[model samples]
Target: MRKMKLPESFLFEAGPRAVLLLHAYTGSANDVRLLGRELQRHNYTVYAPQFRGHASERFEDILDEGSPDKWFADVVEATRFLKEKGYEEIAVMGLSMGGIMATRALEVGDYIGGGSFNSPIHHIGKTRLPETFISLYRSFNKRMGVPDARIQDSIPRIKTKRTQQLEEIAEFSKKVAEDLNQINVPYYIASSGNDELIDPANGQILKEALMPYTEVTYHEFPELTHVITVGPNRESFETTVIAFLNKLNWKEG
Candidate 1:
């Protein structure tokens, strides 16, 4: 039998609340599918969209399209689509880079009841070329070769070291740091003290940003790595999320 191609978007019907899941840079809908399944047990209708340049490329190609505006637009479109489908009680969640987009979505999406960011990249913060990180990136770029300029121009742009795609992850960092006082919504942010991919400082910056928000909760796992929240440490992570949701009167099915 011939295989059928699934839509770039995946929707899971469960509870009354509709929760949109945004995966990290380079991750496909599959990356957050586990989280979606978990949320379903809590009666959340999950919608995870495979954003542009994702779900069908190497990590490098996906990163090539990693502009804030692009993902932000995808989230906006996804939220609008869900709203049209009668999902009024909507919440947004993302992992790593996707978390940044989730925050931006809050600005434009209607009726965002809540949000969560796991191992979020709040700010790139003056890259100063963390020698190791830059070296790794450059090495990967060398292996990946240069991407097509036209293709790169097709997505929403962000600022970076290059003249192209200038949404500059650093700009997101600085803006959030200065204007964190403006976010007035319930948010749950989780991080690991030992997460090498995203510095602990980033999580602290997020905490400071959401401090003024009435229902903000921050949890840290000192011994886990960037992806640990999904694997071995997931139980603790899930427990915290449940408690946080319960504090807001979020119940399971």
Candidate 2:
């Protein structure tokens, strides 16, 4: 539960119709800046805030603090930030961990519409995401010049403890999935047929869960992988997002 002094959040002011982009687990706002810029080019005000413990260099920080409950609180605050800035119409979107947040945001807020990109929404128990995160933690530490030998004990301990937080995320995802029908606004869902961390089949679960009660926009990029907001095929994904936003009945203030 420590703060990182990272000045890496994105706020591109363009129009009154705003967007809140949430980054994936352990990723900074840099993960979504490409898509944010694309949205900005189309005259949307894009705000990509940094999640707690992500901006810091220590992997333990996120392991200890990046629970879904805390992230939901952050997303709520981010939405309020936009409303205070005179933007009444806001759409939320996120990648992976952020996708979960965006879906939950719709349940509680009067959002115009929002969705997720390559989010793991089905069979949370099957994904090797925690292992992926732990691997990423080691890679990041290596990037910071910390060798594996020195951090041997710490990494294992962190891995064991972080599983609890991962469980919290699973619980949150299940709740959001079950509550998808409660949302009155449109929801967008994207999937990668070849995502390394999350199963592509989860897209069907997302579509089926929300389509029965509310409007849902489901799209898939077969050649792409997770975090489409920043890498190859990102532009294509952004176009799909723009089309979704265009169809929304926004009440800009």
Best by lDDT: 2
**Candidate lDDT values, in order:** 0.63, 0.84
Top model number, TM-score: 2
Q: Candidate 2 on 1-110: residue-level lDDT in tens?
A: 22345549989999888999999986889998988888889989999998887887687788666788888899999999999998889999999889889989988888
Per-residue C-alpha lDDT of model 1 across residues 1-253, encoded as one tens digit per residue: 1233433668998767788888765456776777778777887788999887665423334447656667677888888888899777677777776776776665445444455554444553432223333344444444456454533553233223322433465566455455545556577787777766656677776777677654578888787666543676677876776566545544333
* Model 2: residues with Cα > 4 Å off, grouped in runs: 1-7
State model 1's lDDT: 0.63
Question: What is the clash count for each candidate, in the order shown?
Answer: 8, 0
lDDT minimum window of 10 residues, candidate 1: 154-163
TM-score to native of every candidate shown: 0.74, 0.94
RMSD of 2: 2.6
